[model samples]
Target: MRTMSITNARALIIMPAWNEEIAVPDTIREVMKYAPDCDLLVVDDGSTDSTRAVAMQAGARVLSLPFNLGVGGAMRAGFRYADRLGYRAAIQVDSDGQHDPRDIAKVLDGLDAADICIGARFAERGSYKVTGPRKWAMQFLAFVISRLAKVRLTDVTSGFRAANQRAIRQYLDHYPAEYLGDTVDSLVVAIRSGCRVTQVPVEMRVRQGGVPSNNPFKSGIYLARSGLALLLALTRKRSVLTKLEG
Candidate 1:
């Protein structure tokens, strides 16, 4: 489906790319076609490859970080940029091409009713398939985040999401800074800060290229890190940060 027409969307698409030279260009082109109304910004997270050049050639405004900041750091930079640019809204799309541009419209729709809109891959009635220990961890995390959110969340880890002006302002001031911090942690931050968050069912395709940083060993570490993060989120004092009233 064509991206929702925002005639005056003033939207920015933040794509964090790191050594994704193989897929970044293609991803940018597709986003350009699907969401032409939105400005595309590719945050090159210090890729050693040609990600910056290729993304620029594909017509995306490129932000080349001096060093690899991981996806979460890169995302923070992108949001800060958006905040300065006076964008009305912004969405995060990975450069690996796993996200379907067609689903962007659906997620953007939630901005009408909520401060943050997530593209949920396993929401009720979603057709995407998730398997293995990864599935178990996600389901457990989803349950934990759902409880904190006071609403059911089927895909708490989804990176594909949109934030309205209110949420974007908060993001500019503060966002969790940690490996894998942007997903569930960001949701907790958003909710605790009083922002209303909602999800839209959106199926994700297999990643276009590049390998995940997960292995058996790393998987165990990830579980520990994420579990610790959630625990901290639970006990920490809720921020006095004002939630956006969109």
Candidate 2:
């Protein structure tokens, strides 16, 4: 429910696409409708489909990587692009169309104070279903992150998030190169570097197209690996995420 006047257009919406040709257009159009002023970038992580062409036709600037870099690597490229281009802030939206474009504005409202703002579905309970093992996994990650962050966070694994320039810089220099490690470790690095983190309630939808990259087996593996990453995060040295002078 937090909001700020849209005085400047410094926000960039970044969608990381890997074989998401089926849903990319709708995702871009919905984002364009919701945040018309912001620039859109689709980081095509070497998709075999027409992802690059489709995104371009949908009126997005596409950054096609040489090969598949997975979600984390693609997102890192987006942040780097935004940083280099002098964008003040950026938002990461899923290309699978699972995240609601309408709720993007709500996350942006926290940018005035937060270095990064996460869209947490659990904040609203019945708004979205966590279901079974994924539910327990989320709780454990949230507990670890919140306790380390010294502030209560309801959802830590949620991909829907916003970041200011300082955060972009932080990720540019010290972003994790692993799978789910990027999302989990990047936040810890931001906090360790004294950057503000925040969360807002958001509703999520079932993915419209493209098979999920991770199955239940992969999810379990990710949870186990991410758990170890969290423990190591506690002792990881802080990266320089402070705002720099012009």
Candidate 3:
């Protein structure tokens, strides 16, 4: 396994929260306990709740968006922040508390030689309950993404991921805007850019509160849109010439 150089200790953890006031503090606190050396940033995506205040109280730098941007927009904003601050690496953790902050070290370890490291929940056996349709949809999407990007990823939509400076800069430059389609856009971008991407086993939990934003119907639509987008992205010949050109 490739290990991160000691000099690259300046890592930042960014959590994009949307009305997750009740859970943000605990997530931040857990993350701090797990990765104290890493800085934390909470991107409040136009949350009307006390997300910002709670994040601040947890000692995290908070960035409030004037309007509600979906997950992709919020993540794009966080990437920009990481780039601007010159952080060596940035790890994205969801604020819903489904993603365990304790597995952050696993992500960090995977990033030693990779430009991007994604937490693959499928690699481990877990008790986390997922809706039947959603689970099937995710599996299908992962298969499609793997074929298009030519990378065998176990979990394509997993939000828990770590990226290096190069990955952050690339996302800031070419992140997709419309129908972000979960995190497929970011994963495809990283793959096409030839960024070294790795996946490690990580345990995930079911959300503690709040309804899942993506219902079965919404998930179907998202899958269709994402498939179209991926086809277009793969066929279009831009700067990313090969799967690992960079």
Candidate 4:
């Protein structure tokens, strides 16, 4: 495990919101309730809705993107902000409210001994209200990632995760922007770069809105594309290793 400097131990909570006007405020409020000391940042990914206004009103610093960037882009923006502000740790929480904000503490707790901490909803003790196909896809991706990355991850695509400064620097340097299916790409990069990753149980709720961005068909295509990408990533040698060693 990489040893992080204790002097720079501030934690920043980042929410990458696209069109979560209704749930963003509540998510921010819940996160603040649990992790009161952490600073909150909401990266509005060119939302047509009032996501920026709602997030700002809910007491979060908003990073408004001029155009719609995918999840990876929004998260890269958040990581850049955290790096610029010199924050020691960053926790990513989705604004759709599918992930419980109260579980932020659990992620942080897991981060104490690891470079990155992931919140695994399936490993937790709670009911997950998701479509059958999506659930099965998650399980399938978990198995694939375990084989390719050599890490036993229960929730390979979970957005609810925490990363320390080492991870923040590494991701800001080499985050893949296009065809970012899920959080798996970032996790794979971190793990390959010699970061210690740990998973904790987290309760997940159904989206407050009845609709989800991913339908069964779209999700299936995403899974296929991401699976291929992961295989390619695994076959390639570690670029991060060369940089770190050099």
**Per-candidate count of clashing residue pairs (backbone under 3 Å):** 0, 0, 0, 0
Alpha-carbon deviation at 243 in model 1, angstroms: 7.4
Q: What TM-score would every model get versus the actual structure?
A: 0.91, 0.92, 0.86, 0.86
Residues 1-246 of candidate 3: C-alpha lDDT, one tens digit per residue: 233456347888889999998888888888888777788999999999899998899888999999888888888898898888888888889998888877887787777877888898887656554565667667777887777556678887788899887777778766665565337766776677677777888889877667867677876676677667666656533335223222
Off by over 4 Å in 3: 1-8, 129-133, 148-151, 214-216, 235-246
What TM-score does candidate 4 get on C-alpha atoms?
A: 0.86
For model 4, which pairs clash?
none
Q: Would you give me the overall lDDT of model 2?
A: 0.83
lDDT of 1 by residue, 67-141 (tens): 998888899999999988888889999899989987777788788878899999987645676565567678889
Give the alpha-carbon lDDT of every model.
0.82, 0.83, 0.78, 0.78
Local error of candidate 1 at 175, Å? Answer: 1.3
Q: Every model's Cα RMSD, please?
A: 2.3, 2.3, 3.6, 4.2
Model 4: per-residue Cα lDDT over 174-232, one tens digit each: 66666653377767766777777878989988787537667788877766776776765
Clashing pairs in 3: none
**In lDDT terms, how accurate is model 1?**
0.82
Pitting candidate 1 against candidate 4, the one with the higher TM-score is 1
User: How would you encode candidate 2's per-residue C-alpha lDDT over 71-189 as one tens digit per residue?
Assistant: 88888999999998998889899998989988888787777667889989899643676565567777888998887778789888788999888888988877776756567877887
